[model samples]
Target: MLELDASAHPGGIALWGAVLAVYDTSSMPPEIGIHVHARSTREGDKQVDDTFDTVVVKLSPDEQATITGDTAINFYLSRFLNRDIKLLRCPHCDEAHLDAGYFAVRPHRRHMCQACGRQFNDSEKSISNPVSLLKRVHYDVPPVRAPRNLDVKQTSYPGGMQIWASNPALVWTSARAEEAGLHIHLYDSQGNIVVDDTFDHVEVDGIELNEVHVQYFMAQQALPHLSEKIVSLTCPRCDRPHFDTGDSAFFPHVEHTCEHCNEKFVSKGRRKLVVSNPFEAVRKSLRANWQSHRI
Candidate 1:
């Protein structure tokens, strides 16, 4: 039997506080269940006790090996909670699980593996190679607006170009920008086009940015852009919007904290809008196919 426990930190909802996972190997197939403890608070004085909710899954032999070997328990909890929870396991040793506390080192943001004593930098290459944890599951999701290919062209000025896309999320990466020539003149909803100097930065869900990247940006920057373009929910406490910005997994969950009030909330795995761009959709499909081939 393998058991895992997790609790939400202060300022987060009590329902997110308590989580438990149990996997029994003795059974022929294998029995697994995830339990979440929820509590309601009264406005006055009396406090309500905790109530339990559970999701049970039966596993095949291959799936059992996947649960025990490759994935972490938080991955399962993310599925149950329908929110993205960040969990790190050592890439070097592949055994030791690293928590937020493990990244306490400053300046370089380097991580030293406790199990293997391997030191590594927090770069795009390292962060992208997370251990696979979640299995395929079906869910009914809403459709997003389809992304039309932008007509990107070079301008007479050095490092200058013109581009237009219906999806605001479709921004060129540093490499793609350089490949197409820089100093882009973006086309607005109107037929008129303007340079970055003249273009107004769009603000969505309280986030304003001059540019967005397709990949290779830190979570801090990427999450905000994703929140604006993708599905988002407002905080019940402070009324600030929060976004889900985790990798594409079937019914993936993401945990979020409000910037204004510091209240925490979890996304319930339902996207109000999906990525409709063919480029992004194809990229996701290819990536999924590659990952499956690798596994």
Candidate 2:
């Protein structure tokens, strides 16, 4: 319930107060605007190394007034949690910048940001919070290392395995191979056999070139759904509303030219034009109307 402007605190006293609240298992005010949870303790900073503290939490971008304080907050939280922590989906993009990879949830390793394209471990660029993140439950996946014995039998693919893959069109079954009793040959639509030549090999097709990692596979399955929401765009000179487009329209309808700035603008998804910048200035009566919408 402590409310104070960040500037009013010395040596980030306010930040320490938030950390203390979480460490004490106390509830934060609604105005605090972040979820918190406890995590395993980690090494670093004698203070954080000795006590329970905030580990992970989400923060809206605007709440992050400066990058310096954010970094300090993250350092303290990571030491408190003893693990790499990160902001979840970007509030603006609402999409993860980090692509699902083989070691996504591994303990030591950290996930990358699908929005800002920054590694979670890269403290220099990450946004931090005073609260922690809640752990979400997921199907327990086993490791996918090669069997110690090469002569051992191969693993089989689980049901709904076909739904995995970044590019579905890139995946298809080689029925001809199966017909010849050669086993199910999965090809990368380009016919570059991805996990082919192994009839009995279970779960042959993996995200990686070698054996597939389960975390990566599960992530690949959920990625598309996350990508389905919110679009992004770049405004060269004259800004246009790019993220406001609907989900049904194509790129052609999203392109627009700015008269005043004489710059070309483009949108990535189906959202209609609404001035892409969240804080665009009014220009209705300006010389040439710096912004315009494409049909």
Candidate 3:
């Protein structure tokens, strides 16, 4: 018998990763099973949908020799079918798979089937229902930990705000800001005050000020400060170190593309600053920003 566990981003058809465990019903031991961890991505050809790029196969050393060609093929076929790795066929014609690029455009609300020329909306209902070849195996993991030290500061200019952190682990929340005794405000490019309110929470992308969406815009403006303190990690694919900073740093489940090879990988663990004097670091950062403003 085969048991499959899978997970994906919300509204995303692509499966981020999946675990497939094969067990003999008669000899089912909680600890013993053929385990495979497959990580899926759409890195290379953007036109192509998700594909399994990395796979970690785990089996007992004793059972390793028992795996034959037929068994291997069956195992892999089951794994693929369980994870929904197949392309999505057009419901209208069932001839060609829908192009992700065309469907991704916001204005193209309804996707026209290339073969049938029938336009259909990829509605929430359609998205929720995927063609599954095998019974879904329910498996879930704890949510990723929120980044630490997501500090927000009211900017020198009225209605202007900035979010900063020493590392990429910082996740900003309205509650965290409030705890830090900070107030939320919106400002324009010209430093004109836009909105000043006492709101309980602020959705990064939901707030609009002066006809402009402020979702992560303010956080982006303040990212450079944190970038200076970013630590580098060696890319598993390229074997070259890449800086863990910029937009990729803050978001979860987002992969960082290597600058050299363009190989994309997610930062799994947290990297922290070993500051003997954190106060000095803060003062220096502030001083540097102050000097830059004058210049």
Candidate 4:
């Protein structure tokens, strides 16, 4: 059999080679090591990873090494099966069994095979090869987001469903609650918090809410209200927004202390109005129509 280090081979389908030698597993080999496997699969590249579904295997190198060209000789065979095999054919079934040795029973052959259920042969023959993986060693494996969603707030809790970790907990919580119902939170692209009543209890006792699109024709129904106010006082030093709504919306020189930066600054009494409650007022409103099709 041919053996090479080159990556492109017809035998590339094999992640594990066939067993070469079967030794008494009374001990283990020392050179064997493991690799923890994980992959990031989606960010434009993989935007996400699955840590929970990871496997425990001999760790493949994080960076794959480039393999090219071929080695000169067959350093190994398939299953790394080289010239060092020690097996004999069972006369009755033509099956291969580990040859014990010539000296064990010099005058006669005495062997029993479990595989083919062949009776022991009382004839004389030669016995030869032996296999051992006794020094088998395995090293220990040393172990080692998101939000484009609009600021959908839990305006009413106990009213909305909190996802339970298990089926029993979900059933129990559904039964003994002060408030139990279906709840939906809508977040639009370009940052808008949707506030609408339809996002509330559809079944009043439902555990599932149909995910509604934040865009399209039916989006008008799921769209949040666009009439809400946002008040803020930001520090020029720290860029921390403050919520101090004591004076009117038109105070000229509002004294402010930034909790983040611990610096003080003065600015106008600020009360900016953001279109909330399923806000869809966009400069690209026509684009949402002309660029995309009706749903």
Clashes of each: 9, 26, 1, 22
Model 2 lDDT per residue over 62-92, tens place: 3322222233333332332234555555445
lDDT agreement with native, every candidate:
0.30, 0.26, 0.31, 0.25
Query: What's the distance in Å from true for residue 172, model 1?
Result: 35
The alpha-carbon lDDT assigned to residue 165 of candidate 2 equals 14
The TM-score that candidate 2 achieves is 0.16
Q: Write the per-residue lDDT of candidate 1 for residues 1-295, one digit (tens) a residue.
A: 3221112111111111121111111112211222222223222221322322332222333432222211232332233223333335567866544422112111123666657888765553222112234333212222232322223222222222232211111111111111111112433334344433212233221322223222211122122233433343577788754433334312224555665688877655456333211123323443354345435
The candidate that achieves the highest lDDT relative to the unseen native structure: 3
Residue 35 error for model 2, in Å? 12
- Candidate 4 similarity to native, TM-score: 0.17
Model 1's alpha-carbon lDDT is 0.30
Q: Rank the candidates by lDDT, best first.
A: 3, 1, 2, 4
Ordering by TM-score: 1, 3, 4, 2
TM-scores of all candidate predictions against the true structure: 0.23, 0.16, 0.21, 0.17
Worst 10 residues of 4 by lDDT: 164-173
Q: For residue 210, what is the lDDT in candidate 2?
A: 15
Q: Which residue pairs show collisions in model 1?
A: 8-17, 82-253, 83-253, 83-254, 84-253, 84-254, 147-276, 147-277, 159-182
Native-vs-model 4 lDDT?
A: 0.25
What is the C-alpha lDDT profile of model 3 across 159-189, one tens digit per residue?
A: 2333212111011111111121112334544
Write down the lDDT that model 2 would get: 0.26
Candidate 4, residues 164-237, lDDT tens digits: the string is 10000100101111122222332234223343222222321212222221111111111123112322345677
Query: Model 3 segments beyond 4 Å from truth?
Result: 1-88, 91-93, 96-111, 114-116, 120-139, 150-295
